[model samples]
Target: MSPLLRSPLAGSGPDLCYPLLLNTSCRLSLGPRFSASLLYILTFSLALLTVLLNLLLIVSISHFRQLHTPTNMVLLSLAGSDLLIGLVVMPLGAQYYISSCWFLGPWLCSAFYMLSYVLTSASVASILLISLDRYLAVCQPLRYASEVTMGRVQLAVGLCWSCAVVYNGGLLGVNMRGPPRRTSCQGECVVVVDGSSDWLDFLVTFLAPISTVVALYLQVFAAALSQARKMRSSWAAAAVGAAAAARRSELKAARRLGVVVVVFLLCYFPSLGFMGEDVSVNSAASFWSTFLLHLNSCLNPLLYALFYPWFRWTIRLIVTLQILKPNSSRATVLH
Candidate 1:
């Protein structure tokens, strides 16, 4: 067998990641060759899937003018972040997982972690904003149009991304300054925030947003239920029926978005548990938790495809290249 094709674990002389840099290289600690290869394939495939699916969402929402509603504007922002996670963050993560070392050097490592933090915070903030949007639409139906205008939603989306950058930048400033503070040995790229900072991150990014989502969704569902009951008992008038249909449509939208939010939380929650502990990046617990969180990006568009008719129609249009024609952006996607 060729030397290059030989198993990484076979005939190992400590299995240095960079054989040339004996003093500075990291030692490989992976398992069997087949298992490692399988893991690499799985992670890379997931990363690719995340990128493609979220890209479809971005194109569908951005190209179609009929989809340029206040709520879809928020979704567009979310797709942007998810696409970045797939494009930038997941590939780096897969590299780390396969090599079990950080050969990218300290500066790039810091930049990578900073970008990851910002994107994650942005995603969480987007979910929060979505919850708020649904709450207002379902609970304050009369005022929703005036309050959650497209311009206002656009501003809110901008604020979400901006705050994520500023907040996580401040939170992770210490690690970003000078040399990387987390690594103890060469070829190691770990992010170790202090206990206080971890707790603070947990509170601000996870706890607070989760609390708000739960509370708001509860109110939204309650209001929707009451409104539904009212509609069912109302007179059989034409105006009333039209209003009831609109309300039903809004209720369905809220339910679909609620599933997305819940799945996002479920995928993200495990990472919080792992964060409280001192697990290494290469550990099984860490890999699974991180993988689950990243998998949420892939799951989101699938949910939209399942529950959202507009999304299905848009996907069909996008897939067939029908959207390439002139004035296609103005095409009606929603029934």
Candidate 2:
């Protein structure tokens, strides 16, 4: 029996999850049942929305020949990671949030934590790749086409996912051994990485990538401003307007993607705060931080729909099943 299971008032108030195994089973969550149910419903709905939106992005990018650019490939990779988070991580998180127990056993718990870490790290890596892509497109226009090939982008995305898996394995390898090492009680599934490991993971997965994004975006903005000024002053009156329009479009895309990166950083930074110490996954603060991180998946596609007219257009086609039509992949999305 664990200390949590040995509470003096444990069985006196509510029913144990497993009445027969009183000493080992978790106590039912203490709260108004209706409120808990409502929360669960909302969480599950958000998870579903996240999945659907990211799925739309995945399909739109993957199916459209026009969207087969390196930049779109990065977005595709991002949508894939977000899809996994929504489909797998969020549902499992909801179960823990609602039931407040680990009924699924130790191996499943280890696998859940491992998957969560991999997807999250992959998301961060994908954002970094997006920022780099935009930086080159906006700041290094002359070399962008030559440097950022589809093959290179695909290789980078593959490496990002592979590194995520390898990095998390190194960080959480001990915890993945079995229940005896990770869980203090039978009914609880807790992942406890040491403070050192937590800090290292934070630095590698969160801090370093975020810093790179910020730096890259700053350079991008500066270059865009300079380019706008040059276009205004240097080009002939007839050509200036058209050239400026094209440049402005590129700048706008960078700005929109910048918003996505900023939102990602905002949602992700809170989790870093909780990772400083040996944090329990079941803590209230941990739960909220994790919720915010998962909420990023929901917000990402919404950001695309809001900023990218093409996303809205493609979404309409997708929802209406127009994408199933012949040669729909050849449909022009961007004008």
Candidate 3:
């Protein structure tokens, strides 16, 4: 009966989700069969790409000692979460989007939702950590070396992940206790967040992080400009030439990181327009909004490859299988 259902086109009496169960099965929601197949193939392709790219990022950061630093550690965290998104969330989501049926039982369905939520939360935290790292590096360069050390950054990454797991677990706890929320029938699995969880998700995942990141980037760019001025002014000054060069390097790094943040904002900002009293996600707008958010994960590694020469070098090394050679981790990827 729904607009999404393809019972009329399929020429079957009705396309039940579980065709064997006449009394309990839900109707399949889909478009024309050819279009649906093409869409599924595209979605699966995206999932595969996302997985492969993020995996490369993870390996690049984890394997190369030169790539190990406070900033790269946060990137590692982001890549780790993105890898999970591509690995777990995207496949499950693709299946649901194409088939409009939940073959996995209620518990696994809830687990899927929770896992997706946690991984996304971790990505947000990692982005926030990145913002903070750049902020300190640019705005308070004097303290950056001491304050943003590897151990501290590692702990922060750990907290970012552990806290996401615990936080999202509590956020979805209420739904887990009760029966899974069905969209229309027995074969449907969806999370229908009530007023409170919706607001919490909006705030923690969207509002608070967005506000913090925007504020930090604003300051970072402002400071980077000041540093640029200092670099230009002190380039000829023998006493501060070293300082100017350092500041210039930091400025370049900040600009690269800024590109990452700006891309994330562009991808994520559309979702801000999505919140309202209507919680249904059965519309084109909802699907694209979510797809854009997931697309951010895929775009990130590409950005790194574009902005960071080290990333491209590592990719070449990784692709050529040179990483298997002894002490290849010590090979110069960064100039």
TM-score for candidate 1, residues paired by index? 0.92
* Model 2 Cα lDDT, one tens digit per residue, 226-303: 876776665453567775676677788899999999999898777766655655533666667778889999999999
Give candidate 1's error at residue 66 in angstroms: 0.2
Q: What is every candidate's alpha-carbon RMSD to the true fold? A: 5.2, 3.9, 3.6
> Please, what is the TM-score per model?
0.92, 0.91, 0.92
Worst 10 residues of 1 by lDDT: 1-10
Each model's lDDT: 0.78, 0.79, 0.78
- Span of 10 residues, lowest total lDDT, candidate 2: 1-10
Q: Order the candidates by TM-score, highest first.
A: 3, 1, 2
Candidate 2 — which pairs collide? none
lDDT string for model 1 (196-225, tens) is 777788888888998999999999899887
> Which regions of candidate 2 fall more than 4 Å away from where they truly are?
1-13, 180-182, 231-245
Instruction: Return the number of clashes found in candidate 1.
Output: 0
Is candidate 1 or 2 superior in TM-score? Answer: 1
True lDDT of residue 303, candidate 2: 97
lDDT, candidate 1, residue 102? 68
lDDT of 3 by residue, 1-335 (tens): 00111121222236888878888887776767797787778778888999999999999999999999999999999998888888887777767766667789778877888888898888888889999999898788889987899999999999888999898888788646765654556677767666666777788887898799989989988987665565565435456777766877887888898888888878877665645444353356556666777888899999998999999889999999999999998988888
- Residue 141 of model 2: what lDDT? 73
